[model samples]
Target: MSGGIGRRALITGAVAGAGTLLSGCDRLGRDERFQRLLRTGEGGNYAVLRLLQDRTALAQEFRPDQRSPVFRMNGVRMPNGDDYARHLATGFADWRIPVEGLVAHPQAYSMAQLRAMPSRTQITRHDCVEGWSAIGKWTDVPLRLLLDRAGVSPQARFVVFHCADPQSNGTMYYESIDRIDAAHPQTILAWALNDELLPPGNGAPLRLRVERQLGYKQAKYVQRIELVSSLAGINGGKGGYWEDVAGYEWYAGL
Candidate 1:
């Protein structure tokens, strides 16, 4: 599991108070398109910046009222697949995220069971690689809890997310994160956004909110989770779809 800190650092610390995050989401986030058009730091030079990273450093969180008025979707609104369609139609009554590979007690967890577990609600900023951002309130079960229950094996070095959305080439999109971020308090498999059941356009059923990284790492329409020892041979094996296909870095921290 590789990770780094994004040196395109606009924030040095948490925002001061209520409505501050909302102001950025509505006012600054949108306007940044122009700012980003002018300058970009050294391209993908993440390794050097990572030396100063605090793996435990929390991404800046916000007040509920500070959530973006319009939380933009990162990738396709809905994934393509008959199984996903069936699950969606039934409100995911039977859909389950199978925790497989390198776990002592592997099992698929249903949405009902996940919701009944200990949950955390957070309002955090999602920084996109494209230079825009949004503050959203998300409720999710901590990934650490699920991993603990499943008893992840010591050999499992990376947590891979197998998603249902496919790209133009017809391959499904997938992403991976290491155990350090996996156990981070804010790393959650969120089922709700903005105090409501996720809308189809917003990764209904489930999505990952790995707040420390870029939006691309926050995979949507996730179908299964595989804990693997290495990323080689998985898809393009660079750690994520964009990382493999688009040359994005595997560990995109901010």
Candidate 2:
């Protein structure tokens, strides 16, 4: 769960507005070639970058004062359902993140338990595939520590994130990352943004912040974390909701 790109190859912080995210689908959707480029070219680029870059290199971090004036909430604003509403009404007190799959000990962590764990806060920029980006502060427990507590099995090659948000077909939205990104120092399951409890529009209960990748990789409304050996059986099996339907690359390395 560790990997890196070169120090010079890293992006400092290029912030784009939320609008780019909304139009990303149509822009890429209409152009078959553009989508193909990402699929064939970008995917290989990620592998090459991984080999050339330092596995432990970290994304640039900023000060609180440098936070974005407005951090746009992307993806399902609020997943539709009575269960989700009830949890929201109760301020996610009963919500829990179930860690299962290829773990030695399956466990469900309540919000309180997550907050009680050691946490890291960082101000970093988010880059969306569509063309927009923003900088913001996020606070959450290091995902690596959680994986350690769960005792990830040697057979687990990828980490799957089951989210509360639903995709177009009604299946719950989900995403995944290789062991490298999952163990990166900056990758976290952020429960708070901008120094406050995460808002519903921004994945209130929990969201992932895998800073080195594009925004789509930052899954929101995370309900479960499952370590697995393969992504072949999950929903369209491309590794994410957008990737399954919209052809986004699984490793959106930037």
Candidate 3:
């Protein structure tokens, strides 16, 4: 499975798996107007969820024995490109997660550098909106630690993950979280899963894991982290690839 599965195939599998629950929502995938309406509804839910939830609420964590026997790979399985191929071949020895945009000191961290920093490990469940769930252990550096080291600017309002994988529409895959989520204790840039160096199917090298949100919010194959005041100008301005294409909610809070 090193080559990984195609993005369309993964979506189809998810759609099929959740068909029973999505009986009336099928067309939302292709209807732009409906998607916008759907987003509006999701926005309201988000507002209410945020209002009622604690600022630093933590997602439930599990014990090692509770981890799922098999964790399905989500989102883009393999990023397409010679450069990515080279990194994969070299075991990401030369790969870097560049931190830039609205930061006082922009910095890029190689795998070694990122691994050298203090890391946190947690066994947690990943609930996908597609009506499935899996529990796995994730280990990585807290995003705030990196942001502090980078000296994130006071004006920055959101952290955007620029990934190596692109959607079928050729739009580069990305996801964003507000400053509040960025500084959450469970929010990390994970480089390992299940106590092992993350496999390609599970976002090797690095990935964003904002534990409080649903699986879609966890952007994988991350290449860069961009700090910005707003997501209004990125892609379709929906804050994420699925949000722009599949009408998936941007704020997929549990």
Candidate 4:
């Protein structure tokens, strides 16, 4: 079968599984069956999607004049916690991002230090999983430069971003990227937007800009950077917050 046909079959199977549970008298609800389908098909779906993404052309970028006048911030608008509040109150003077794991050097970089690094500016569109897109300009140090400075180990296959956003159950938000995306030119730790310092509502202090993927891949309010060979033990072992809790695709390649 063609790749497209195969993908369609996989999706159809998953949907059919969901429909069965919805119409049955079984104790398992439709939601449970949907989650089970996602769990069972996640790896294969990711592999197929990744193959297609790798073969496709790079995602389009926007002209500076085409950038949005006001890009609406998606996800947690403001992190709620005493620690985050204290940093905000103090103007983030003591805010630091701890960088460690599978590296020759481990260091805690203050926001000022991160800002001092050489930076890149790009006008790009953020496509959210919920069917919205916004173009904006961003400026930040490339993640590759920071990873290089930290001496990333050869075995490090994934870079995980730990954020400060806390859900009702008190679990922190986190996401991971493989080495290919990690070394991509557009992967940056953004500190500014639209030629101005980042606003608190839009992930002030620092945020990740992973241009090839969707908005959620660009984790906001970043607090820690970890290099890991595998994501088996991080946050329910599904690789990200949404992946663990909402059955969202872990490899959200555009």
Tell me the spans in candidate 2 whose CA falls farther than 4 Å from its real position: 1-38
Candidate 4: where are CA atoms >4 Å away?
Answer: 1-45, 52-57
Residue 23 CA error for candidate 4 (Å)? 1.6
TM-score of each: 0.80, 0.84, 0.84, 0.82
Candidate order, lDDT descending: 2, 3, 1, 4
Clashing pairs in 3: none
For residue 133, give model 1's deviation from the true position in Å. Answer: 0.5
Residues 1-254, candidate 3: write the lDDT tens digits.
85598899889988887886586567665588886676687779889988987989888999999999988997778888788889999999998888999999999999999999999998888989888999999999999999998999999999999988867898878999998899999999898998899988888889889988899889988999999988998988879989888767778894
- Worst 10 contiguous positions by lDDT, candidate 3: 21-30
Backbone clashes (count) for model 1: 0
Q: What are the per-residue Cα lDDT tens digits for candidate 4 across 1-254?
A: 35656877889998998888667645443467665765667677667766776542456777999988789987788899898889888888998898899999998999899889898898899989889888999999999898998999999989999998897678988989888888888889999999998887888889988887777888888999999998997978878888888767777873
Please give the lDDT score at residue 38 for candidate 2. 54
lDDT, candidate 3, equals 0.88
With a 3 Å backbone cut-off (N, CA, C), the pairs that clash in candidate 2 are: 1-179, 1-180, 2-180, 3-55, 4-55, 16-133
Model 2 whole-model lDDT (C-alpha atoms): 0.89
